[model samples]
Target: MSTTGFDYTITRTLDAPADRVWAAWTVADEYAVWASAEEVVLDVRPGGAWSSVMVIPGGARVPLTGGYVEVVENKRLVMGMNVPGRDEPVLMTLDLTADGERTQISLSQTFDTAEDRDQAEQGSNFLLDSLTTHLAAA
Candidate 1:
């Protein structure tokens, strides 16, 4: 079996409603609590820019910056996230769906190279897990 090309998706059921879960992605305060896990200044509107510095498990702070390509009010989001050493930005799209008392959040990322895509999937899913934990805590 050969794994070629790069496409990854992480879906999490949040205890919060779609609105609250969406807020975690849209607002500055809540976005910091999860995605970056540190100080994050989010500009969520279409064409807006955002950045974050996250404290890793070993106390290292990784800086991430991105721009919002699309924002569909509480429903969908498309962003371009950049890794410091990479030239091409990874493209991401998140779909928020309401499921009874919970929200089903799906995060999808596409990368230029298979390695970059695989690496991004492995790393970013951890952040999504952290997001679930943060939202559940709140």
Candidate 2:
């Protein structure tokens, strides 16, 4: 984990290829399996919309919507997240690089306030852990 300015970043080296990791981010079905959400809807291109209903523990549902700001196949994806109760959208960037058979996924989420950034870190970490588990089971 790292931070600079108003951004919080997390990086993980996964035992999966970059392409597979890209698919998990871009494809709704693949994403649903590991996204810590009940459903995922993603168009996956620049300017496309990304939305999901997260089913947190105890069955509480949280809906989140966002749009893709940039997309680079198998490499990078930048999203503008429209979080509920927030006036501004947070920008998240996922940078992937191949490390032999594995891939390094770097996630940077920039928010307008430190409180917002801190609030998201735990959930972000859990989702990454879920992704790792999902890949291990594949």
Candidate 3:
């Protein structure tokens, strides 16, 4: 299989169709509603910015923001995320597919270190869980 410095890929199926799932990602209001468990905002277009304030236990909050690099309708999305004092930004890619009754989503990310990759995988899994919860309500 293809590999990056440290590969991180997460795949899941949503009960919704690909188009509907894509909608949630592309619509700022819709995204904030389902994609996050805390304060979040998305610009929803290429070169647009996004930010989210995620509150952890003990009331600690972490904030992340970035700009979308590419957005392919119902298929692919790529974004560059801000990370502290790094020579390069973190990149995230979403590959999506629609089956008859479900949407299959895969997120691929590369990191500079194995630790960084693991951390991102953990955070992304949580975010995906939150996204699932949001879609369940739709």
Candidate 4:
């Protein structure tokens, strides 16, 4: 299915450089840490594929698969994530801006319905919170 527009967007500033923030998304090990994934494989180039097995609460494992549509180093990334139970992959765009020692990140995702988008916001916030913690420790 084709998405008309993004349904959800969230922005956060992290206490880390843009490069580091980018690594957290592009690097397998770093992504695994913050994403709470059992395994992660990332190919951070245009048209490259990425996959991860996320370990959710109660020991359930969920597989996430995606492909990179665009990559601009520490500046921007756009990908399509195949969420379970969805007919089409969700388009995700992440933009990063470096402000001295901090990085401002804006993430947008497209969903088919407003209810789905609203429900996903909570999970997105939790994921970003994990990223913040990982960055702080790094």
Best by TM-score: 4
Winner on lDDT between 2 and 3 is 2
Pull out the clashing pairs in model 3. Answer: none
Tens-place lDDT digits, model 4, residues 20-121: 999999999989989999679999999899999999979999988999999999999999888778786777889999999999999887676778788778
Using lDDT as the measure, the top candidate is 4
TM-score of 3: 0.86
lDDT by residue for model 3 over 72-124, one digit each (tens)?
A: 88998898888889766788999899897689999989886999889989988
lDDT of 3 at 30: 77
Q: How should the candidates be ordered by lDDT, best one leading? A: 4, 2, 3, 1
Backbone clashes in model 1, listed as residue pairs: none
RMSD of candidate 3 to the true fold?
2.2
TM-score of each candidate structure, all chains considered together: 0.85, 0.91, 0.86, 0.91
**CA-lDDT, candidates in order:** 0.81, 0.87, 0.82, 0.89
Each candidate's root-mean-square deviation in Å? 3.2, 2.4, 2.2, 2.3
Summing lDDT over every window of 10 consecutive residues in candidate 4, give the lowest-scoring window.
1-10
Candidate 4: where is the Cα deviation over 4 Å? Answer: 1-6, 84-87
How big is the positional error of residue 34 in model 2, measured in Å on the Cα after superposition?
0.9
* Tens digits of lDDT, candidate 1, 3-111: 5457788887788888888888888888876765567887889889988887778889988788999999879999898767878666788999998669998888766
Ranking 3 against 4 by TM-score, winner: 4
* Model 3: ten consecutive residues of lowest lDDT: 31-40
Per-residue lDDT tens digits of candidate 2, residues 1-138?
Answer: 224557778999999999999998888988988887766889888889988998888988999899999999999999988867878677888999998879999888866678877887877899899999999899
List pairs with backbone clashes in candidate 4. none
